[model samples]
Target: MSLTCGRILELTGNSPKVVVACECLAAGGKTWVLLHERHGNPLASIDFFLKDGFHLDEVLGSSEYDFELVALQPGDRLFMKPCQPHFVFGYAHSICLDPAASHLPNINDFDGLMDLLSACVLVILGNVLDFRTYRAPSQDEYEKANKNQQILIDHEINSIPISERFAICYARGVALRLINWIRMCSEIRGPGGFIITDLPSRFFVQIAQTLIKYKEGANASKLDLQANCTLGMLTKQIENVVEVDLKISSLWSKRHLIPSGSLALANQGDYSVQWPDPGRKKWSSIERDFMDAGVTPLDRLCFDTQHDRQHLELSVVIPQLKSRSSASQHPPKRTKS
Candidate 1:
C-alpha cells in the first residue's frame, strides 16, 4: 500500500495523527518513519526531555534506538507500517517504537522477549525517567505551524525514585514529556498541529550519537559506576534484529528449501521466490533458547532441524551382563564351529 499520499494527508488533517506507512524516499522494503524534535544545531539532535533532565537508562520498556548517519542519506525515505505498536513512556519527549514485525519476520523469533528485556532494564536503571522530549529547530515548514508542539510538556514532576531527593530529577519529568509527545504525534495536524513532520525514522541516529556520549562519559565518571547502558543498548538491538518464533515451527516453512534454492541460483538470473506461512505453533522459552544457542550462525543461514522438529533419537547402552562382543542375537562374523 502506498501510504505516502494518504498518510501525508492523515498527518495534515485536523488532529494530526501519527502516520504508519512506507517511506516514500527509502528503498521499497527497508525503511521506517520516526517523529522527533529537531534541536537548534544543524547537526545537533537533542530532545527537550534530555535538556529538561530525563535520564534514559533503559527502564520500563525504555531502550535507546540508534542509527548511524552514514546509513541515512538526503531524501532517503522511511517506510512506515501502521500495525506496529508505539508506546509512550512517562516523559513527554521520549517515545519507543516497539518491534515492527521484528524487522525480520522471516528469521528471528523474539516474541514476548522484548517485554522481559524492558522489565530487566527498568529494574537495573532505577532512576530512569518516564517522559519523552524533542528540542530541535523545525526541519520542515509544516512543523512551523505547530511550533507550540512544545506546550504539551507540563512542569508537574512525579515523586519518583527517592535516593538523593535533591539530585536533579530528569527521568520522570522528561518521560512525562515523551508520553505527551506521542499523544501529539497521534493528534497534531491541519490548522493547528504537527504540520508536516511525520514520524522521523532517523530518530535512532540521534539516539545513537547520545549513547556514544553516554558510554564515553561513563568511562570518565569518578565513581566508577557500573553503567548498564551498553548492555541495554545491545538487548534493544537484538530485539530489533531477532523475530519471535511466531509460528508453531515454521518461518514460512518449506521455508526449509526456499532460501537455499535462492542462493543456488546466484549463477542464474536475479533470485525470486515467495515465503509462505506454515501453520500456528507454540514453543516454550527453553525451546527457543536451545535453538538459538545451538545454531552457530554461518555466512549462509543454516538450521539445526532437531530444534524445531521431533525425530527418531538413537542411543545404545550395554548392560553389565551382556558379553563384551555382544551382537543382536546373531553369531560373530567368519566364526567356524
Candidate 2:
C-alpha cells in the first residue's frame, strides 16, 4: 500500500487492475503508470522494451506508441483493462492500493470483442515469457533462505537483480496458475462466456521465434510452414508426426472447470483438487491456406479422424436441438388468469 521513494512495481500485465491513490507525503509525490491500450502500442514495441533491459524512457519516447503514462495524485483512481501491459513507479513516498481481476466491458460489437481477446493473447505470451525467464529455487534452498538470512541458501535466487524479484515470484508460481485459470474461464460459448482471451497463429509464430532467441525450448513437433501454404500442405507436414487427420483449433480452444463442491469440502487447509480433461471444440475452421486459416507452428493442431469429428459435431448439435425443442414445448409464464 505504501511505497518508499524511488520504488517501482516493475513491468507486468495485470488486466483490470485498479490503483487508488490514498496519500502522498513528498512535494512531488506521484505514481507513474505505463499502460498498453487497445489498438495503441504494438506488442513488438513492448517486446523490444523487455529485451532491452526495461528502460522506461527509451520505450516511451522512441516511437509513436499508444502507451499511456498516467501520473496519479492523492485521491486519484486509475482502472486498466485486461492484459494491458503496465507498470507503476513511486516518484516519492506514497500510498496506493492496487486490486486487479478480470472485469470485461459489455461486448456489443466485433471490435470490442477483438480488443478483449487480443489483450488475452498478450496476457498468455507475457506469462509464457515469465515462465521461461524465472527459475524457481529448490525446496531445500527455499526452506533455508529468508530475506534476512545471513547465510543465504537460495543463492541462485538471491543473485537475481532487485528489479526482477517480483517477476521471478510471478513466473515461478503465479504465471502457470493464472494461465490455467484464464484458460478455464475463457470458453467460446455464447454471452455467458468468461473473459475470452485467445492467441492468434501469426503472433504465436512471432513469439515462438522470440522465445528461441530468449533460450527457451519448444518441445512440440516441428513443421516448417509459410504464409502461403495450404491447409492440405500443413496437414501433410503434420502427418509426419500424427497418424490421423488433424483438426486445427486456436491455442485457446480447450475449456476446463473445477468440479462442483470441490472447494467447499476442503479441510485442514488442504485446497488441492484434480482437474478433468479439457473439453475440445466440436467444430473447426474450413479455411484453405495457413494465412487464411491462421495456423502457426506453435498452434496445437489436435488430431481426430474425419468421421470422429463429424460424429462429435452431430453429438453436440443433436443435444442442443433437443434442449431447444424441449424448451419450446413448455408454456410461457402466464399472468394471473
State, as a TM-score between 0 and 1, how close model 1 is to the true structure.
0.19
Candidate 2 weakest lDDT stretch, 10 residues: 259-268
Tens-digit lDDT string for candidate 2 (1-337)? 4453321122237643332222233333465465453435344332433333334455454344445677876655454443345676666667544343223422233333334334434443432333212222332322323454322211222233334533433332332233334344334322333322332332233333343422321112223222222343233333221211121123212212211111111121221122223522422333233222222222222112234556999999999999999889985788997
State the local distance difference test value for candidate 2: 0.35
Which tens-of-lDDT digit does each residue in 1-337 have in candidate 1? 4213213112434653333332233322222323322233211222222332223333222323422121223244333323232232221221223223433222111212222222322322222221111111222322321334333111111222223322222332232233223323232122233232211111222232244444444444432333222434433422322222122123322233322211011221221222123211221122223223222121002122222222323222344326544665566689688
Score every model by TM-score: 0.19, 0.30
Winner by lDDT: 2
RMSD (CA, Å), each prediction: 25.6, 24.5
CA lDDT, every model vs. true structure: 0.27, 0.35
The true-structure Cα RMSD of candidate 1 reads: 25.6
